[model samples]
Target: MIERDHPTLSVGRQCRLLSLSRSSFYYRPAGETELNLDLMRLIDEQLLETPFYGVRQMARHLRNEGHAVNDKRVRRLMRRMGLMPIYQKPNTSKPAKGHKRYPYLLRGLRVERPNQVWCADITYLPMRRGFLYLVAIMDWHTRKVLAWRLSNTMEAEFCVEALTEAIQRFGLPEIMNTDSQKMVVSSRVV
Candidate 1:
């Protein structure tokens, strides 16, 4: 777990040597109150059941369930959870500076061959004590997973590592699809 041997080395190279996901290295524990944790858990479960519920509906549902939560609290919790009702709406999530926003390039494009298009997604990993983030690449045509990596931090570099490994193994795809998440579109890594 010590990188002292390689003085002034790149972090990604160090991470590769340890057989550990870079995310596992930077995961931070939630510092919210126990009550807020309870509320977040409740809100997460409810959101899973009804992703369309906005803060107003979530607050009402929580109140009906006797949680004593208000809309403002619910809104904050939802933002923390990265939960959004999937629908057509303004792009509320913004990318970081200099991160290239790749237009959705695969709208009606037919993926008739392997590696024609690939998609990447980052997800949260629930643990008994804490959580980690997982990034994965998938082939659009065969629905096959090409590469995946997990990390404890929200840094974009872990996603870059996953992307690099995917490209090394399968070569670059004609199109790579990802949500508006900043990590996925970072030009610094590309």
Candidate 2:
């Protein structure tokens, strides 16, 4: 720490001793402007409603709300604020290392009824700081979300809870399908 008001050592002397530039020693960073602060607050609110909104969408949203904003401006603000939109990643269909491949039983069979086949997926809900894991049970044919649960950690409780809720409400399906990773985690706990 450079003490500016040192009785013996001058600010210049202290900076030289520390090998610091004189300008850097006296530099004071300018924080966000008032307009930028207001815009950031609005962006944060919109992010809460839709975590998947990218720079383009956020810029459009701000423009629609009567704010003179562009994608470039929104992109810079979001990058500075450490905000990122969650989207699908590539190669998600590929299985992990040492994971066994299962036969696609539904390939030849047709799923017409709602309860004929059910599927569950474990996805994470993005947040500002961290994210929460979500387990959703859906009817395969109807594409309706029967039940969903959120948890801080990826464990079997939330998955089992969602499955339980779905079964209780819509009854059991003839077949239940989920990711292999999910089955492993759930089997370990359940």
Candidate 3:
């Protein structure tokens, strides 16, 4: 925390003591304007109805609703609200650059026994207010869910926790698969 008008301490000194950057200490977040807020509300309501609407579609919808807005503004507001079209889009599954790529090892291998292969996936569960991220680890042969965890944010910690729990309960599998690009192959798995 930073106090602007401290009794004796200077702002710079307070920032240094708190291990915070001077710029961050001085920075204040800009609030959305009334028009932007109204647009955001409309976008949210429309998103519930048409989850597949992209920037262009959203802009057209707003225009039809009598709001004079451009695609750029709609795109910015959608990004700010963390909303994305739910439909499948091309090139959305690219792996991160500089990350080690592992070949798909289960192409021809048969999963004859439980724990032979395991798969994990993360999905979003829509709720009344927002959505929750669900991560699950399952046995490939048996199709049994070994562990699951729900999180408000889509961070790797919950997925890692679920994997850890599954391994602890059922022991390690011969192979593990996931669609996430951020998953790193540990030495134990290798």
Q: Tens digit of lDDT per residue, candidate 1, span 1-190?
A: 6464567766667787888777877778768999999999998898889876778888999999989888889889889888876433332255678976655666677789997778888787655334688888998899999999888767879888888998888776767787863223333334
Better of 2 and 3 by lDDT: 3
Model 1 residue pairs with clashes:
23-151, 23-152, 24-152, 27-152
Q: Which pairs, if any, clash in model 3?
A: none
Candidate 2 regions with alpha-carbon error over 4 angstroms: 1-69, 74-101, 181-190
Off by over 4 Å in 1: 1-94, 181-189
**lDDT measured at residue 129 in model 2 versus the true structure, 0 to 100:** 52
Give the TM-scores of the predictions, in the order they appear. Answer: 0.46, 0.48, 0.48
- What digit string (tens of lDDT, one per residue) describes model 3 on residues 54-139? 89999999999999999999999999999998874223245567868777777788889998888988787765356788889998
For model 3, the run of ten residues with the poorest summed lDDT: 181-190
Looking at candidate 1, the ten consecutive residues that score lowest on lDDT are 181-190
Model 1, 171: alpha-carbon shift in Å? 1.0
Q: After aligning candidate 1 to the native by TM-score, how far in Å is the CA of 16 from where it should be?
A: 76
lDDT of model 3 at residue 61?
A: 95
- Return the candidate ranking by lDDT, descending: 3, 2, 1
